[model samples]
Target: MLKPVAAIAALAMIAACGGSGADESTPPEVTAAPAATPAPVAASTPAPAPVAVAPGEPSPEFASLPAPYNAANYAIGKRTFKLCQSCHLTAEGAGNLVGPNLHGLFGREVGSLPGFAYSDALTNADFIWEPHHLDEWLTNPRAYLPGNRMSFAGVRKPADRDALIAYLMLETGYTSAEGDAPNE
Candidate 1:
């Protein structure tokens, strides 16, 4: 049973990437994994969606984030970040996963994290990570730089990309001052 479930999930991922020769006009639906059973709740009360920080009250870790990035956007970005959690980690001192730990990604040089084995395409590139660069990269990593190891099809929506970038900036310790530096 477990094997069958895994197989179905794998197939779903492939189909989501347009691997099944599905129609191109309609967007594909991708499920990372089978859903787990929810715990029982009282009939009168429904489970509320998880919120990382309450509206109007940002978490201490993200309180310094500037305007246009509020708790609401943070929550959306947190949810969207689920797509990236399997490959990357945002916490400081957390070692690399399939991708590098992204604690200070905003101002860091691309592919320059100390321990991870970056692709030659990235390692040979000369550039720093800024919000705009990250936005383009997340829009389509493969198109942005070929021969990289990441296999994500890329986030297709601009709004999602914005939210994800904002989330990354907040989580990865981006400061307004970093935005002032010219990308090299």
Candidate 2:
């Protein structure tokens, strides 16, 4: 009885100190609390820094465009493109976002990309994409084609429209053929 009471008091002391009452020589039970091991530190690799383009120098992406569209206007277009980035992707194999991926857009028929779901107005329209048509469409999408689904309020400035069209031409891989002239 006295030995059992002594064991109980030892357990009480161990419990107060947040320890198991088992002797140090005794092996811990399978259910015993595990000894804490420090979490392994993850080896972080730094992300590659963005390539900086010099002022007045055209970026490699815009280098192939004609003189006026290649340098200063390309820069403006690139800046303006930020507004469209939320919906569109210009890379050739990139997946569609809110709008369809715009690679090979210049000669493509309106709403003709295979996987994208276009509105009935676009799907039924007979026009191919061209700079002037794009300009009018960007001027006011809703007014240009009533019942179309683009939510942009339209680029009001003609210069901005020009820049944006030139940027899209370069980014979407337009190559000049006989009929593929920029709007004067």
Candidate 3:
């Protein structure tokens, strides 16, 4: 009785995983070892497929991702940063409180805010905070770049995130390629 049910379920899984999508061409591994008395159930479930991301690159955002990291966006970022004003400051090289000063975020290492007690999650991170990375991080923050110290859920507005990154780009002195634009 149990063998009949298990056989039906195994057939279903084989059919489902036998797709030519992302996992196409990959051979399936046998998890349930063949047994003398005919085992009751599939011992272990097949591992779920990995999510596909573009190779060797970060996901792009904004137009040109607003690179040269626009001055307008930086100014806009300052204003949007007002949302953070209660807890943060954006001068030259500041520190943290409810949050950090955010003085030099761009080009800076992730989770590398000086003097601030950072989470173990960020301190070990290997990625640099760049315009593209910042956009991604600010997009969903916790989801985008997990392990960040920020407790505030995150800003949902893309424009606001853009502005904030632009402002940080200016502070970090990651000079933009945009012509004739004085960084804010």
Candidate 4:
């Protein structure tokens, strides 16, 4: 009986030394908790930094677009761009489909990309592809330039057009500040 009581007391002491011995009346001390360790990042993979973008401007990459333009905007813009994807390829070095490959379209001349067949209406048009011009073209392609080869009716909603253009600007590496003068 004496040996069994001593054994029980030793086990009780061990239980108290462990964390599980706290009584119901005593609250756990938060300071006693171990600090959280952050997940380690792989050295080879760097996160994208946000790029500054002004209102009515385009970003070079979707991940780099600043606060007002977030991943949500990219998602919406990406979905909107599906309307144009059937005819265009926004990726770099991608071949032209039914329409021209739209890589680097923002600053290029309307019909200047080589190899792709452009309609006479587009070829004759004298305009560089800036945001405003793109907006107009998207609103009504054939109306913007009669006899253009694009058969699909243009995007009617201004917001939808804006989103699609934003997506295009991202995929094509267009920077809002590309041609801007230095503040200095």
Highest TM-score among the candidates is held by which one?
2
Residue 117 Cα positional deviation in candidate 3, in Å, after optimal superposition: 1.1
User: Against the true structure, what is each candidate's TM-score?
Assistant: 0.61, 0.62, 0.51, 0.60
Q: How high is the lDDT of residue 51 in model 4?
A: 56
Q: Candidate 1 lDDT, tens digit per residue, 1-184?
A: 8999999999999988868766778876887898789998877877555455554344444445543343225666777899999999999999999999989997789999999999999999998888777777888999999999999999887666666777888778777745632234
lDDT tens digits by residue: candidate 3, 59-142: 222124344444234345556777777877667765566876667665577777778777777788787666776666666668
Writing each residue's lDDT as its tens digit, candidate 4 over 1-184 gives 9999998999888887874555857876666678789999878977676455554444445545432332325555777888888889988899999999999897898999999989999999998887677777888888999999898788886666666776777778786644322122
lDDT by residue (67-167, candidate 2, tens digit) is 44454365667778888999999999998998989899888899899999999989998888877678789899999988898999988876677678788
Task: Give the per-residue Cα lDDT of candidate 3 at 12.
Answer: 85
Q: What is the lDDT of residue 46 in candidate 2?
A: 82
Model 3 TM: 0.51
